[model samples]
Target: MDLSALFSLMGKVALITGASKGIGLSIAEIFAAAGAKVVISSRKQDALDEMAGQLRARGYEVTGIACNVGNMADLEDLVKKTVDLYGTIDILVNNAASNPVFGPVHDTSLEAYDKIMEVNVKAPFHLMKLCFPYLRESSNASVINISSIGGISPEPGLGIYSVSKAALISMTKVFAKEWGDHKIRVNAICPGLIKTKFSEALWSNDKIMAHMMKALAIKRVGTSEEIGAAALYLASPASSYTTGTVLTADGGFTI
Candidate 1:
């Protein structure tokens, strides 16, 4: 079988959140390279504009929209703008998330919990709803929730953040079931210890990296591009038969 044929995303229209940098940005680049019209969103307009310009310079079709996923109005606007520009949202990658606090669960506060839930959980749900019309219209549609490996198992120090991701995973399953009739596939990617700004604390320290390596089968931190490739598979025709699945890219941390 020519496996590459299944992975092609050419002419697809993809909308990605938290796309100014890291995994989100990498996904944007990969999808664009594969000939998709990519729409990137983040809270920072300047950064999103810069990234969009850079991608356009490389001959990719791209657009940038400043969106704070926590705000329903912003999400509505994001969906409207994408549809206005491209007429449809073939793929939605819910990659925006938050980890405002660390330490034990008991030490976490109501404010922190709410904050994390608003971005990590609620926002994705809202975005899905707002984009449902466009997604339903497409012959091929996919929704990818960027969850974390912490949600799959547990991380004592990550408390509420972990809880939020767990809820996201649950949301993926529910949405997958509800949207199946529309031929829209909903799934999640639980990334392990990736070398990104969001996980600098874990991989930046040599001692922590050494300890983490012991538990990982790959014995190293994962990269954003690695996660990007995984996102590509889930978002493209490659994973046409896949849905309601949580694809883990954590370097075998769960093993």
Candidate 2:
């Protein structure tokens, strides 16, 4: 097998959600640089526009669409727009997620719990459903779900979010089995604590940082580029045989 073919994502179209900043945006950037026409979505159109413009300036084919993953109609519109722009969706990175509440499980309100599940798990599942047909047509179709190490092991003050991530991991397995016949490889990326704005609540806290310093083998938080690199591997041919797998990119936080 040619080694270069393993990492190539040329001639593919990828859609990423929660792509205005942090890991989602990084995935969009890396996917575009890998030669895939990328569609980025998030709640804010202005942020998406900026990201898309930056990627396009770098000579990659990229478009931005605003989407609130919690809304099914928005999801439908996102799919329609993606297909309209690129004709088909070859790759999908469900990187959009939420954790609106932070406290004990007992203190969590019903609304917060529902919101967490809606964005973190349900949205990914439904978006994949919407893209199933287009994904099936591609010989190199892949679905990369962004889960978290918090899902693998319970984290302090993050109850519902962890549960949702765990469900996402399960969803990844189920879809991998169901879609395997169509040659669509479904996988989950469980990132360890990355140093992104989305994770400021953890890293910005002095106590949490000290705790992580001792628990993590890598002795530092992960980077958005690190997650982006992992997404590229799973999105490209490098991971052709990898499916129904949770590729954890946390700085060895589990260990």
User: Model 2, which residues run further than 4 Å from truth?
Assistant: none
Q: Rate the local accuracy (lDDT) of all candidates.
A: 0.92, 0.92
For model 1, residues 1-255, the per-residue Cα lDDT tens digits are 866668878888999999999999999999998888999999999999999999999999989999999898999999999989998899999999989887878888899888999999999998999989889998889999999999988775788888889999999999999999999999999999998998887778788778888899998789999999999999888888899999999989997
Best by TM-score: 2
What is the C-alpha local distance difference test score of candidate 2? 0.92
List clashing residue pairs in candidate 1.
none
Candidate RMSDs in order? 1.2, 0.9
Superposed by TM-score, candidate 1 places the C-alpha of residue 201 at a distance from the truth, in angstroms, of 1.6
What lDDT is reached at residue 62 by model 1? 87
Worst 10 residues of 2 by lDDT: 1-10
What would the TM-scores of all predictions be?
Answer: 0.97, 0.98
